[model samples]
Target: MSLKILITGAAGFIGSNLCEYFVSMGHDVLGLDNLSTGSLSNIEGLRLKDNFNFLKGDIRDIETCRKAVLNRDYVLHQAALGSVPRSINDPITSNDVNVGGFLNMLVACKDAGVKKMVYAASSSTYGDSKALPKVEERIGKPLSPYAITKYVNELYADVFYKTYGLNTIGLRYFNVFGRRQDPNGAYAAVIPLFTKQLMNKQSPTINGDGTYSRDFTYIDNVIQANEKAMLTVHPEAVNSIFNIAYGERTDLKMLVDLLKMSLSKYDKSILNIEVIYGPVREGDVPHSLASIDKAKRILNYQPQFNLRDGLDEAVDWYWSHL
Candidate 1:
């Protein structure tokens, strides 16, 4: 059945994609974004659709949050200031947007009597743990302010459910990358950054000897997780957290080689480009891999695209932008 949904950060990389998916499925989507980090170009393609509505606002404002949540069947809260390095530089802004704003959304949702609230959490919350595949039950210390914010989100989410009986689900995203992930900014993710550099015949930057690994989930996988979480019939799945990642790992070195190989077919200059290695940034994890058994069991979450396919699509998008 089609539902009335409110998607915060709907102009963002993942949020925009979610809007498109839901609109195509004949659902009514109300998208709220302040244009901070999100661009209108990302959602412009959807504004012409009759089922999609766009509202420019910040989640930090409780009134705005309350207004957006009114009569919404489900709330997909994707508005957050991502990136560990950005958080490390300005923790207060990150805290206000990620933690403070998240709290506001939860309270607003509870008051508005929304059916369910599914939010975007981060895998960085599993900081410093050496577990091969991270489970939701086991977590280590938060290494960065960003990780702390995400962990705190889970805490607040649980508390809200316990205190007010608000149905909430947190999907912990790991290294999500794909089309519309901004590649020109200083805070761009490795995949988009590397893709852009390769397309432009420029060197890509790698840190810490290119040995650092990540789960490297795709955009489609994240969207599927969100869709499943929002529509799951199991009562146990509600008011819980799940990892939204493909259960695999890829190191930086391998990623660079893959990007060059893919780009070389169209542009030979990419093959001669060298990746520059530098100091590892603070608050960055060395390796990250997620166990999706819990998500599979609960939400029936299955990732449709792996890293190679995701990278191919990402690079192709960059090629178009260039």
Candidate 2:
């Protein structure tokens, strides 16, 4: 059955993809984006669709949040100031948008009586933990302002669920990358940034000896997690946070090698480009991997694309678009 959905950050890499997926499934989609970090080009294809409605608004405003949640069956909240480095640069702005804006959305969701709200939680919430595959129950102290904000999101969601009876699900996303992800900005994710540099015959830089690893999840896998979280009828699924990842970790060196190999299919010169090594980033975790057991048991999430599989597609998109 088709549902009425409101997707915050609708012009962003992940949110725009969510908008497209829901619209393609015949759902009525109301997209709200401030376009701060998001680009309209990401959702340009959906602007002409009859079932898709675009609203230029900020989630920080209570009125905007309330308006967006009205009469909506489900709310997929993805708007936030992402990037640990950016948060470190301006912790105040990150707190304002991520924490303050999140509160506004929760209050709006509660008052509007939205059936369910599935938000983009972050794996960075597992800050400083030495565990190999992170589970939901165990977490370490937040290492950065961005991590604090994301962890706060989980706390607020839990409170709203218990105090106000709001149905909320938090999907702690791990290194999500794919088409439409910005490759030009200082805060651009590693995959797209590396792909762009390699495609331009420029060398890509790796921080910290290229040994740092991440559970690089594909965009499609994340979309599936959102969809399942929104539609799940199991009582255990609602009002709970689950890790959305591929259950595998790939180091930076391997990641760059894979990108070069994938892009080499389009341009052979990409294979010869050397990677530069630099200082490790501040507040950056050495390795991140997620235990998807909770998500699988509850949401029945099965990630279809592994790192190499998704990298193949992502590299192709950058080759054509860049």
List TM-score per model, in order.
0.98, 0.99
Give me the candidate number with maximum TM-score. Answer: 2
Q: Give one digit per residue, the lDDT tens place, for model 1 in 1-322.
A: 8899999999999999999999999999999999989999998989999999999999999999999998999999999999999999999999999999999999999999999999999999999988878999899999999999999999999999999999999999999999899987879888888888778777888988999999999899999999999999897898899998999999999999888877777788788888899899898889999999999998999898988888888777778776
Question: How far off is residue 73 in model 2, in Å?
Answer: 0.5
Q: Per-residue CA lDDT of candidate 2, range 151-185, in tens?
A: 99999999999999999999999999998899988
RMSD of each: 0.9, 0.6
The 10-residue segment of model 1 with minimum total lDDT is 313-322
Task: Give stretches of model 2 more than 4 Å off.
Answer: none
Q: Quote model 2's TM-score.
A: 0.99
Give the alpha-carbon lDDT of every model. Answer: 0.92, 0.95
